[model samples]
Target chain A: GAGVSQSPRYKVAKRGQDVALRCDPISGHVSLFWYQQALGQGPEFLTYFQNEAQLDKSGLPSDRFFAERPEGSVSTLKIQRTQQEDSAVYLCASSSQAFSYNEQFFGPGTRLTVL
Target chain B: TQLLEQSPQFLSIQEGENLTVYCNSSSVFSSLQWYRQEPGEGPVLLVTVVTGGEVKKLKRLTFQFGDARKDSSLHITAAQPGDTGLYLCAGGRSGGYNKLIFGAGTRLAVHP
Candidate 1:
């Protein structure tokens, strides 16, 4: 794909169920990030990955939230035992640099609805 | 706590009018970026300001960063219907891993 892409544009999960969202960043991009956004609000940072190594997970809300980028190109965010408050749009973004001013390109985002 | 705050959460204006959106923060950032997002898509980068007290213009849009690198303002001149969308401001820290701290955002509706 020419830009970042996310799978399952919309997902509905019952409370206490687990869900995994996938992201495919631009080819060869080094930095990947995950964010959660509520309706009519801005994105909140979740985690960050540089290549295949997870560098920052400070923004993850709880121990149930997990993310990984095994190959540096594709990434996944897993939420275990979801709650009602967990409903939000999960966004993925990638940049060409690790910690620079390079522009971060974003994906369409996966809207997760917890029922 | 929200590190950055945006004012006028919702804006509705007529075409050809001008408006300004503000993003304020207490902490400093290495660089600030502006992005526009549609209803069903991702945010697209508009511009980035690296230096404090810097100003950048994109066509009818003008962006300014505060001298302390703690705030930013976006000014749109002669807005059109095409300018309607959610506008976001994100900041990157110098020693961080390029993780963006974002404001709540300002949703602008330019009606023709």
Candidate 2:
């Protein structure tokens, strides 16, 4: 079975530009999550989706960050007016069920570098 | 905010040596998971411990959950070069949207 997958393995963007990172979750996965990983640090939660409904997004650092999982399968995390601080690896994960106890399958991640 | 603190942020050991990484938190969790990530790759789940005082072993790797469910540990016996990577421990609270709080991670480098 295919695991979660993210596009644009690496992206270099100028500050103030907008970037959208895409995620393809495994088929029939009911839970999806987004996380931000800074260098030398563990991944920080960003948002979550159960099907097409976004269940929680309190972890999003700022208003500049937004995400959507419309249609309940594919998701996207978009950053508006990117800042140098936004540079990090954006990871997407999915689990078969909506329960938090289930193990999440993670994607390779898209490294965004704001220059 | 629930924070998971991992000790020994960085570790370098020779192959065949044993090592242990610890994750501690002030808040209790319903479940804890250990993940291993190599360079340029997303973290791969290693083990999940839900019961207090629980121990699960994967080959030479052993995982333990604290009796209080507030801490966990991973011990590798006879480490190999393939064991080298960032080890992360994540805690999931009992309720909410199933958000996971992750530790800063311990970077392990095993030299053969």
Candidate 3:
């Protein structure tokens, strides 16, 4: 794809259920970011990956939230024991450069709904 | 806590009208970026200003960074309905970490 792509555009899960969202960043992008956005708010950073390395996960709300990028081109965010508050749009973005000066390309995002 | 605060959380205007959104913070940043996000889509980067007191223009949108690097403003000239979306401001400090802190965001609605 010419741009970042995410799978499972929308997901519905019952409370306490687990869900996984996938992200396919633009080819050759070395920097990938995951963010969670509640309705009517800005995105909150979840994690950051520099190629295959997961350098930061400070924004993950709890231990139940986990993310990984084995090959550096694709990433996944897994949430366990979901709660109502965990329901939000999960977005993934990729940048060509390793520094903040680079522009980021974002995916459409996966909207998770906890019933 | 929100590192950045955006004023006028919501704005509604008729097409062709002009408006401005503000992003403020107490901390200094090395660079600031603005992004616009549509419904069901992720935020798309609009502009990035590295130097304080810098001003950049993109078509009908004009962005200004504060001299102190603690604030910024986005001005739109003759906004159209297509301009309706959520605007976000993010700041990153130096030191190579490059983790961006985002503001609460401003939702703009332009009626045609």
Off by over 4 Å in 3: none
**How many backbone clashes does every candidate have?**
0, 0, 0
Worst 10 residues of 3 chain A by lDDT: A97-106
> Better model by TM-score, 1 or 3?
1
DockQ of the candidate models in sequence: 0.80, 0.77, 0.71
Query: What would the per-residue lDDT of candidate 1 be over residues B1-112, giving only the tens digit for each residue?
Result: 7898998899999999999999999999999999999998999999999899999999999999999999999999999999999999999888756778899999999999
Q: Report model 3's TM-score to 2 decimal places.
A: 0.97
Which CAPRI level is candidate 3?
medium
Please estimate how well model 3 matches the true structure, expressed as its whole-model Cα lDDT: 0.93
lDDT of 3 at A22: 98
lDDT of model 3 at position B45: 91
Candidate 1 Cα outliers beyond 4 Å, as residue runs = none
Second chain only: TM-score per model?
0.97, 0.95, 0.98
Over B1-112, each residue of candidate 2 has an lDDT whose tens digit, in order, gives: 4399998899999999999999999999999999999999999999999999999999999999999999999999999999999999999988655688999999999999
